[model samples]
Target: MADKLKFALALALVAAGVVGFYLLGEQPLVLRVLAVFAGVGAGVGVAALSAPGRRFIDFAREAVVETKKVVWPSRKETVQTTGIVFAFVVVLAIFLWLTDKSLEWVLYDLILGWK
Candidate 1:
């Protein structure tokens, strides 16, 4: 409860600082930096206050650990995949161009009676 209150108070101070800056027609850089830092601090305070937030942090930590266990693709594999992607793109472009020209031929020569 105390942490929640502190979080809210910190957020309010950040908000007030921003509004005051705009109202006063562009405040100092130091003040803006302080406001941003305070806002981030408030967010961290809120996250620290709750069990669910802590659980998320723990899950993220475990995910990073597990990620380290997996083998990443080699540069040779990456280059091969990129080559396959370009081939597919070229094939699809040819297919689409054929379809478009066929549709144009049918619509102009057959339907509307034009050359």
Candidate 2:
């Protein structure tokens, strides 16, 4: 029950922020943006007080920890892999171009006798 109320309040805060942005359209762009950010920040703060928000925070922390455990490739390995990819792409492009030109020649010059 308490969690639901907190979530509702957070949603209201966010909605109010959006409404304020449109209502303050005649104001300076900087001020309008600031108002919107302030509302969003407040909404997030209120949401963080809720049970679901706490679970989300826990999930985010776990994700960061798991990310840190990943084995990233070295700069040299990355560069070599990228170069290999580029070479393969170039070869494939040349092969396709030759295939297309060959088909065009056979269809137009040899088969159709158009030109």
Cα miss at 108, model 1 (Å)? 1.1
lDDT of 2 at 74: 100
Model 2: per-residue Cα lDDT over 6-111, one tens digit each: 9999889888888999999999998888888988999999999999999999999999999999999999999999999999999999999999999999999999
Residue 31, model 2, lDDT: 85
| Candidate 2 clashing pairs, residues 3+ apart or interchain | none
Worst 10 residues of 2 by lDDT: 30-39
Structure candidate 1, residue pairs in collision: none
TM-score of each: 0.72, 0.83
Clashes of 1: 0
Candidate no. 1 TM-score:
0.72
Full-model lDDT for every candidate: 0.77, 0.94
Model 2 root mean square deviation, Cα atoms: 1.9
